[model samples]
Target: MTIKFRFHPEKAVEAAAILLKLHGKPMKYIGLLKMLYIADRLALKTMDQPITGDRYVSMDYGPVLRGVYDLIKGQPVDSALPLWSKYISPRDSNYVDLLQYPGNEELCEEEEMILKQVYETFGHLDPFLVEELCEEEEMILKQVYETFGHLDPFLVAEWTHDLPEWKDPHGSAIPILVEDVLRSMGKTEEEIEDISQEAQREAYLDGALPKIFG
Candidate 1:
């Protein structure tokens, strides 16, 4: 009498097949991973996060571990978890180094000029980011404290939500994630694609021909 939120075995196999197709020539392990990561990120965007003792785990992990507990008998999962997991955890540097900022002290004019120059040069963005500052510079700066824990209050109103991001599960993260995988698979090197070029352009190109043919 054990129930689990696990994928159906046949379904899992088929899903793995689909992932293989999606991953193209990637190694089996890498392809499997991309499938899982993409699925988890998507699930996070659409579901309530699960409660797990001290910290809330992603809703994706919830299904990945449903049988462990009926747990307080069906209370709704908390919404705070997503904000914490997505915005706060990495900021604290307690977990995986997703996207991290040194700190958001107002960049000196020289620093600002440097960032503007570098960001403009390759059109790249903050490190450890899953998405882009796609919002207004004001909005992005406002969140900088939350993101980097030290943005100057004076600069809070600067970022607009218009920069850009990769699409779908990727949003701002698509380009980096794909490229990291590619690099790991020996497809490309860090020096090849200029970091100034936004990951969005690369991901868009990745999908174009397939979408066009489809």
Candidate 2:
């Protein structure tokens, strides 16, 4: 059986606030969502848990934290609504502003470092451009899952090395996946499923089940 993950609205709001403060200006909703997703992904890769523990869904732009996305749009999410309304700007605006300072209690030192690193890496780029890049990354990630059926970051990185999209001009080790390469090579569905299931089983044994399942 599949298990659904829980969302922490307070943490989501706090995270958004932190990102806004770090940015030192208003951020577009799309951009803020991408930053939050990257931070959560990093946390999941390193700490065995995500910052908000929100459900991730693939969208046209990229992967999004479903609950947080709703909150950003000022939707009435029961747990996060009050706090979100209190500190976050209205959904009518394309730009999100931090109405209050976020306390650091919800985020740990490691999580902060990951968020900081993400900001330093992508903060200067246009949000729309970042979204476009993320769309490509998301497609690659889906192929990786379909081909490998696992969430092991190291293995995924190694597998992505052979793909044409896997470029490193700056020598910075960005995360990538290999399923697209497999697809290009025309691997059969049966073969892909068999290999993906085996890899997913290994991932589960490695304690990555909850992060993905949840």
lDDT of each: 0.24, 0.55
Question: lDDT tens string, model 2, 44-140?
Answer: 4454345665666555445556788888887877767778877778765677788877566656656656665655555544430011112222222
Q: What lDDT does candidate 2 reach at residue 167?
A: 51
TM-scores, one per candidate = 0.20, 0.59
Clashes of each: 19, 0
Of candidate 1, the 10-residue stretch with the lowest lDDT total is 48-57
**Native-to-model Cα distance after best TM-score fit, residue 37 in candidate 2, in Å:** 0.8
TM-score of 2: 0.59
Per-residue lDDT of candidate 1, residues 1-214 (tens digit): 1111222222222222222222222222221222223332222122211011111112311112221111112222343233223322222221122222222222222222222222222111121121211122212222222222222211211221111212332222222232332233343343324321433354456569788997
Off by over 4 Å in 2: 127-214
Report the lDDT of model 1 for residue 211. 88
